[model samples]
Target: MASVDLATSYAALILADDGIEITADKILALTEAASVEVEPIWASLLAKALEGKDVKELLSNIGSGGGGAPAAAASAAGGAAAAAAEAPKEEEKKKEEEKEESDEDMGFGLFD
Candidate 1:
């Protein structure tokens, strides 16, 4: 589980650095190509959690601001909870988008 989580995060970082939109399929492909076993649910969950947000900006702020250890930990926990709450809605939207893209890529299902 931890390896899968780390794989997704690394994939996301690489995508962001390359100026690519982070998507579940892309993350999964990366993990799979590397022979990492990642749960689809986890990849999709992360994709949703990161939706509509600037990955670089989000990651850059992770340890920039200074605060007391307790306060910092508290804020981090709160932020994580909020992200979890928002992910479900984004997940639905992402699934719809992925379906549309898949259909478009099929090109009349010539080979499928």
Candidate 2:
């Protein structure tokens, strides 16, 4: 698809999720004026949606009628999933270390 179409599709998804309901023509015009690539714009919108919402919401917003290169969407999803998964692992490791420290302190009867 043309860059304009991709931009419009991305904008439509964003607007729908935000309840803005803007026209595709407006989106095309804005993207053309900004000269930014459609993939980046779509990625940004997806990121924003993910911030205050769940993955299901984000997927529903962008799953249908959203237009961008398929490869871009796939890569973006993969990257986001990897990052989200890693975040929990890191948090768990930190919690484990904290727990160990707490156990050591209790063993010393520091609180008593």
Candidate achieving the largest TM-score: 1
lDDT on C-alpha atoms for all candidate structures: 0.85, 0.59
Which pairs of residues collide in model 2? none
For residue 2, what is the lDDT in candidate 2?
A: 70
Query: Against the hidden reference, what TM-scores do the models get?
Result: 0.56, 0.28
* Candidate 1 structure quality by residue, lDDT tens digits, 1-112: 7888789999998989999988999999999998998988988999999999999998888985664554556568897755665677799999989987888787864356
Residue 62 lDDT in candidate 1: 91
Candidate 1: count of backbone clashes, pairs at least 3 residues apart or interchain? 0
Q: Candidate 2's residue-wise lDDT over 1-112, tens digit each?
A: 4765566556656555666545434455556666855544554554454445444465768755644555455567897755665676799999989987988877664464
Whole-structure CA lDDT of model 2: 0.59
Candidate 1: stretches off by over 4 Å = 66-112
Residue runs of model 2 more than 4 Å from their true location after superposition:
1-76, 108-112
**Per-residue lDDT of 83 in model 2:** 68
